[model samples]
Target: MFYLPALLISGVPLKEKIVLRKLTTLTMLLWLPLTAQAFCGFYVAKADTSLYNQASQVVIVRKEDKTVLSLMNDYQGDLKDFALVIPVPQVLQQGQIHIGDAKLFEHLDNFSAPRLVEYHDQDPCQPMVAYAMAPGSDAMTKYKSDRIADRKGLGVTVEAEYTVGEYDIVILSAKESDGLETWLTSNGYKIPPGASVALEPYIKQGLKFFVAKVNLAEQSKTQLKFLRPLQFAFESPKFMLPIRLGMINAKGPQELIVYALTEKGRVEANNYQTIKLPSNLDIPVFVKNEFSDFYKAMFDVQVNKHKLSAVFTEYFWNMGWCDPCAAEPLAPAELKQLGVFWLSPEQFSGAGLPVQITRMHLRYTADSFPEDLMFQETGDTQNFQGRYVLRHPWQGKPEQCEAAQTYFKQLHERHVQEAKTLAELTGWDLANIRQKMDLKDQSSTQTQDKQWWKSLW
Candidate 1:
């Protein structure tokens, strides 16, 4: 299935959606690397960014004021219809812009996605010795003389332009949002209604515009099935993402996942509350089959509970290793392609090279999120991930031995509690969860068996 890139700004033809289709969640069959065995549980499945529709993904590699921002656009339509208008702190030079590999994003997504891990039950009669597992770890475009004069009159300046990879990029500094909107509409970029309001804030902040459109001829040469990600590097004090522009033309609340790589520690939203998703919970084994559904439902519940105002920390850990890696740790070369400027090739293999990655997910509407995302890097290096657990019950019968009997009895209680936990997390009906587990609904059984006249005085 075709998946949409989430990193787009002012994408047009306004109706051409950057949509994501549902992917079959890979379950127990996924091979966990040998290194992952260091963790107490075995890696089973994951809920990656692909599970959501209409989602965007951004990678921010920042150290001090130096920053490299990469956007993956998931546009599904005619190549000619694709265009983007993003606000930048300054005009980017030709050397500063680049087209990046989509694989980088895929590797990062798999590495940091919320994961599902499992542990098998040891025989009740045998000593549990396996429990002691070790821990693992844009350039401006050139314009004609009359074009320059026309742009000047409209309070707009085409600072620079470049044809990088398959994109035709233009850098613009606008004096007013209205004039900028006019310039865009006049230049064949279909400006959605109410775009002026969205453009106003960036203009007021003295930010420049990085505009891009598909060069169909160049794109055809690549013979690629999807657009390659666009990347640019610059120095700026502002550590934020301009999402307001993307929302102006959106039909509904948009999903965004930001992967931030920093030297000191994890990154978080400065203006909004950065909450962590519920993780490390023991769930029913049946969830192994429907882990995708379980995650979506749980995410929906979290969004509602927070009123869609919170940014959720899905994963945060040092890049050197993962306790129960969803995928292998990224290689040093991959890190360089991702714009990790501070790390040298020699330092990539060293554990001392500080690279902390933070994965943040958000589901937001214009009403719930009134401002673009602003971020701050913190020194907190605590390792966290949105991980769920499933423990396979022992197959031995209750009558096999004394320990077996005890195990089955305790297992029943555990199953009941697991069902309750699932219900609470996903808002699924408790009775239905119990039925799916093939366990009796004790509540209903007690109700039906109780004497109706027990309350008689």
Candidate 2:
């Protein structure tokens, strides 16, 4: 017989989506460095001219000191009033900045988000064979110079300034946090309360500030409902992300999801704990209809269980392909679109570029996360996904034969175990979940009145 991988399944289009337009900025500050997808940073404030809110997504592709970073937020506020403050290890030139596709982030998110799959158990009464399965899966602003006298007076230098897409970009260097804060407010970018306190550290580290705001006129021309992602590329020895700035005035904890791609291996946090998200458990079939709600509730339980102090890797797999693909391996073109600078023309042989992707998530407050996210690409190449399972048992009646009776006995036992597993993972009441499972539908469950020898037929 011809052999095929039992896990082989056609690519399924993503059904659950977190609409980008539905997101709001709450007052999130973030920063990241270059290695693969090197650096990221942001600050959110309550004022009209500032970005505020939770849940930001970033993609970092890094190798050594070279990095390509993409920053995205769901800022539904007025474009004219929006502003971004990020940190950089070096000055960014006009060529180093570009506008990225928002759809790409959605695609990556869909492809990497936790997945739910189902299996049909063959009747154990019949002879059966089992087979093994396999699996897999920003631009800087420009600064202006002619205002040297004005900038100098504030002890800040506008390194470069130019229009990139819909953003007015400015790269700035300051001698002190106070001077930088003074320069930013004077230039129409509102520095949030206590910004100088947060800016002091990056300043002392000799990092430059990247400031970007949407130009309303340019934004109108794009004819898009949301801001396109911002791309930044540069070389630096650091492999980390800055999150302290985002915490400056945040009302509560913020969530960030990172899609890190590398040619070497999986990417994970170094300073904070990096552990795998729970996976491969048999859950109630009802989860199929409410996977999104199930995932969110499950994730919340996990966060609380860890006391909101850990980073969870949701998916980590080689990029060549997937067994049960959430979506197809991102095409080479898509990778390039997100700033995978290492894939040269000659490198695109019959074999695809050797890239590994790790999706990590965390929620942090000023107290829970005190330092920026530091990362290291690990040598571990094992493939993993946040996959949950639902197995539909054979429904044959126990009166059919002795095998059927035995199968029924097993089914009843399996249902009990499955309920226990679901309760363990989600904290839902086992009895409640069992009721929802509708055990009344099963003949095995209905046959509790039969004698033990009768169950053997």
Candidate 3:
């Protein structure tokens, strides 16, 4: 029974308010137009974070040394029982903390989610044409006089405390993991049994713990049912996320989806094998009905293939546009709400900002992911997505024309290959796939035409 993990903490805020110069990739602009003219497909479905029950979503907007990290809470327990403890590189001041809108995260998830797209095959007799495009609250209490002395004795210092939105946040610098865990437990935080072990690494590295709890009184004022995400802005040279603390009390493997918005092209895990998930595969049209299951099964296969140690990049593209958009490109104002701090006020009324988003997914356990995830932004502007294609075969009769006959003959081969691809991807039984497609067998494709079109006038 894992709750929302202490997924992110680190960075300093730029004091001088350095205006980030917008840098657009010329190559991306040149090829961007081609996307609208080349791929003629309609987005049918998406595999968003909602697919995983225990998935935790985090949004990290980074530029140079500045970062805005947002953590989504999916805790389904007593509000009082919910708590978060993360290690930050520096003490986050009151001004640095923020309560973000949950809708922004949803928008990010939907926009970057892996999509299932469908393209109706063009008539064999007619020339092909080009088509275009698409697009928590918490509260906290004070320690008694004796407890305050005891905390000092344990080498625990509360650097700063604030009630940001409905959350009561405390920044603490600690000397030892055991003492930190002891102080947290004594202070009413439910410290899991093995938390001290996880806290040791972060504590040893001189990181400060940013703790938060629900302020039920404040929360009631908002009249919202669920807790909103907590965000913080800071500056630091380290590009990493602390996921180790999240594994302490997890029931099993936990899902984590990171939406990284950066000024450059794409983000990849610096220390782990970052590979793109299998994409742009031609799959049986039946997948349109069961895409959710197919995506889950395919992801499970990928997790096993990588031994649950790799970071899978699901989508990487510029925020301005999408080739076959799962959702419309995020507007500039929405991007700012998600912590794209560099966007000037003037840019909000015009076109979208120069932001590239990289969506990475991982299913991790403590043993498999021993280190916190370190990240690096690469200059690779090439766009990629976990896009599965479904081509509805032309419904015209095979005997209508010579071209129609040839189309059917080749369509049979395509169906066989599609079945093979689906079987390989999802590890589902090939026979079941063929059965669903009405394919008798791979050896005979002509006998099983999809649509029963009698003739064409």
Candidate 4:
């Protein structure tokens, strides 16, 4: 049998009896399931009654409507338990019950990162238009509007058109004279003093022009060009130059529009050169992953009309530990083992057909971690310069020469002295170190040495 605690209702007023009765009913309703379970041989086990047995099943019903409220114990069995029927106000159904702590929501909001939205359009040939404030021109103000009576009658709009070629060219035209002449003189388009006035008609009509020409064939077209230095042999019967194209637009699958500017950096497209490449030839090409999407968008543009073949060639260089005391300079044993470097299209090669590399610059850095004395001594020699001299194949003694032989002799002496110092510090035999360093140095030198062009004919 279960015992019920005595009620502490002393000194209660008679008028409050109805409220007391309702509380008594609710208490009885909450205990009904435990009472029935006790009678059914289910034990009411508890270390502390303050801990509610949440695992137990509970059912709530409306008492005024004669509905049943059945609460179950943790161990439900074949034996039937008594049902608790209690009266509850209809308003209790409208309230909500919340569980758990409120801080969980704040943690979730803090973990999210900013998101980026990318915008791209299928048409590649979209023109870029911009209006910039003229450098020395004052802002137009209503106060000064009457300075020139022509201001009321003058209406001006400047139009700039560009096209592609050896250089970019631009033509600027406007209907107003003040702005046109101001723009031309400020941009270095002023006519020479005492020169013939044949250009007067064009200038008076508010026209300005600029031109920029560049070699196109020497530009890198693919990823392979970035991996290493490229050697270009222009065997074309006609002088065809390679040009590096910037900001090209694929207006349509067949139409590619590139902004052509003149040498004076003006937009002009009056003349265009179109050449078509041989469809039968397949040339390997490479481009960085970052530019993959850009190239894909431009692949359909007609290449044959440009009369140019764009091929991607793999180029690479390597540097490793070198011992100045040893006979040879140190480099990667194989191209694959070396630290591979990549360059952008502009950095990879020159642009233009029959590309001529007028200037070549190379820098090498070496590091030796204590083990090799020769390598350690040479680490401070940061810059070693060399250049290629191009001459006709049959020229007995090429007229063109880079750094004289005296420069090479000086470089050789520096290497030898550095190697000797390293040998003394590392406790390596001078003879052995010299032999090894010499072989390595010779191999490296041979690989990079440039000589006059020799014809195979």
Candidate 5:
């Protein structure tokens, strides 16, 4: 005879005596069924945490002798937690089913279709039920022959049951063309087509509409219009400024107007005042119909060879600033009398040499010259007599010079490696010996060169 366990402590006679009395009564009253009804048949209902939380719903089914027993609805409680508990039925031999909420059932459709069935063509309708073992019933060993068939086909009929809040959900699944009779008979759950319940209105309304309407009104403002061409110029012999075309009140449907400005002079008939004007401009105009199409249509206008060289030379000269120590002093007489005058040379005789070398020596030693070296006496008067000397003769050990040369060679190799890496990373031929590199500007080129050199160590 078995009853719910009770605890007894040693040396507690009074509490032990009360427990003994309750245990004797429970044994006499409940022990008979515990022993004799162990062989009786029953079905068990197990709930999953997915069924407990509000995230998803579940459907349970008996694996054999499909029979719907109960339906549980909105099982997701306030705590958003769930536990699996097997509820044993008094009639142990009966089979039952459980149905999850609408969302979970639909999700299961993607994994295994034959295992789930719909009732009344309703997505969230009552889930059908089938045979399942009773709680702690050892049915896995005793009823081994009751497993369902694993039929493989495009579609197959199955009986499923769900328990939703005290309701019994029964469903049958089959292919679309098969009549209800064939489906019900195949799955062993036969409810006449006329007896089936109609689908709920809410279920029908929940079906998503495949076709959607998009409003074009929001896109209307994106429509762009073209305006008259505007002209500007990049000054000759120094084309640093880019030619610009001004657009006003431009909207969408973007269009491009490219016009080449020809340098010309405007003349006033009466005053003979000549003003510069642009002429003979050949402009291409087109509307861009697509995002990709617009960028592809753009092309660079290369200035003529003569124009480019002239611009390059002018730009280089403007950047050149060399000190001329031969130039006469320009200080005030008071400053000259005080021997505070300094003069700069007015001429240089080198070409193709790096400009950095010319500025280095003067910048480093301008304030360190001796006063006697810069001044000389002519009879009774003092005259300016400064002499500038530039010397860079190699005068170190051969090994020392070899070390410096090796250092520079290593730096150059590192630059080559970095260029190779950049080329590989960006798929741009940054250092291909045969190809001309397209540097952004002189500063960018210097930065890249410096960074590559610094990485050698």
Candidate 6:
């Protein structure tokens, strides 16, 4: 249960037709263009965060040191026991905190999730070719108590506190990690073991802690069944997320999907290796129905292959529109609600929002990620997604024309090739894929056209 994970992300995209090419690489993962100016296909399906069991979602809207961050999670337990502590660069004032809508997170995830696209091969004799592209709330509490001295006068200052929505927010600054740990524990917040050790470096760096617990009365007043997301706006030079604290309480590796909204271009991890997930592989059409299972299996395989140390960029695109949107792009109004401070009313109506979106996914345990996640917005704005391809072979029969006969000969070869690629991508048994593809009885020479004469037109 990695329910204790911390994460952040948010972005926007609009569809624009651009040129594309058939990705022929064996197992290499690459981003697929959403709409092709020259060679694009209809975007069909997408792999969203719902595929993962214990994933956390975050949205980050940033311009320079200034950032608006929203945090959402599915805390199915008692709201009374839910508490969150995150390290920030500075103390947040009353105006900086907000409560956000959860639908904003869903919209971003749909727009940025890795997708599936299909292209039926045109008649082999066709003049040109085409390609395709694919793409929580908590209660509130009230704050009343004043600053109180702790054991040994350990310097833990309650810098600020506020009742925001259903949360009772407290900002703290501490001089020593042990004192901070003791103070939090004494106050009835369950400080996870080894948290003091993780808090040391942040305290030394002069960071402030933003703590929140549920306020039953405020929550009941909201009249919502679940917790809404918490948003905070701040300006700081550090572009990073505090994850070390999450490791203290998680039972296993935590999963995260980040939707980063930047004014200029894509965002990536600056401190860790940022790798793109394996994408744009040609697989059998059977995958369309089982995309979720396939994606999880493929992701698990890649995580093990990478030893779980790297972060992955799943999608990065400009947020004006989508070619064949898996879900509609978030409206400018929704973007503003998610804390896109720079977005203005004019931009929302005209050419859509100018903001770009970057979707990053990562999984880590305490052992794999020892430090917090650090990120930097990149100048690269090239479109990319964790996209899978399913080429529905042209169904023209051998009697159609000479091209049809030729196509059938090559189609078998392509089918065999597709099978092999699927096996490699998912590490599935070749025999099983062949069985599923109905290629179990075909011989090498026969498949290689030893019987080419049988199909001669």
Which of the predicted structures, 1 or 4, would earn the higher TM-score when compared with the native?
Answer: 1
> Could you tell me which 10 consecutive residues in candidate 1 have the lowest summed lDDT?
36-45
Of models 4 and 5, which has the larger lDDT?
4
Q: Which tens-of-lDDT digit does each residue in 246-265 have in candidate 5?
A: 00111111111111011111
lDDT (Cα, 0-100) at 438 in candidate 2: 70
lDDT of 6 at 76: 42
Off by over 4 Å in 4: 1-150, 153-176, 179-270, 277-280, 284-457
lDDT of candidate 6 over 140-178, digit per residue (tens): 221111223345587998889899999888899999999
lDDT of 2 by residue, 185-294 (tens): 77656666888998999999999988887777888898886778899999989988888887776667678888998987889898988889888777777876666556
Summed backbone clashes in each candidate are: 9, 42, 14, 67, 40, 35
Q: Pick by lDDT: which candidate is best?
A: 1
Q: Tell me the lDDT of model 4 at 29.
A: 24
TM-scores for candidates 1 onward, in order: 0.82, 0.83, 0.82, 0.13, 0.13, 0.81
**Deviation from native of the Cα of residue 91 in model 3, angstroms:** 1.1
lDDT of 1 by residue, 153-228 (tens): 7898899978999888889999999998888777756676788888888899999988887788889898886778
TM-score of 4: 0.13
Better TM-score candidate (3, 6): 3
Stretches of candidate 6 off by over 4 Å are 1-53, 121-152, 348-353, 440-448, 451-457
The lDDT values for all models are 0.73, 0.71, 0.71, 0.20, 0.19, 0.69
**Residues 92-130 of candidate 3: C-alpha lDDT, one tens digit per residue:** 989889998877776677677777666566678863433
TM-score of model 2 vs. true structure: 0.83
Candidate 3's TM-score: 0.82
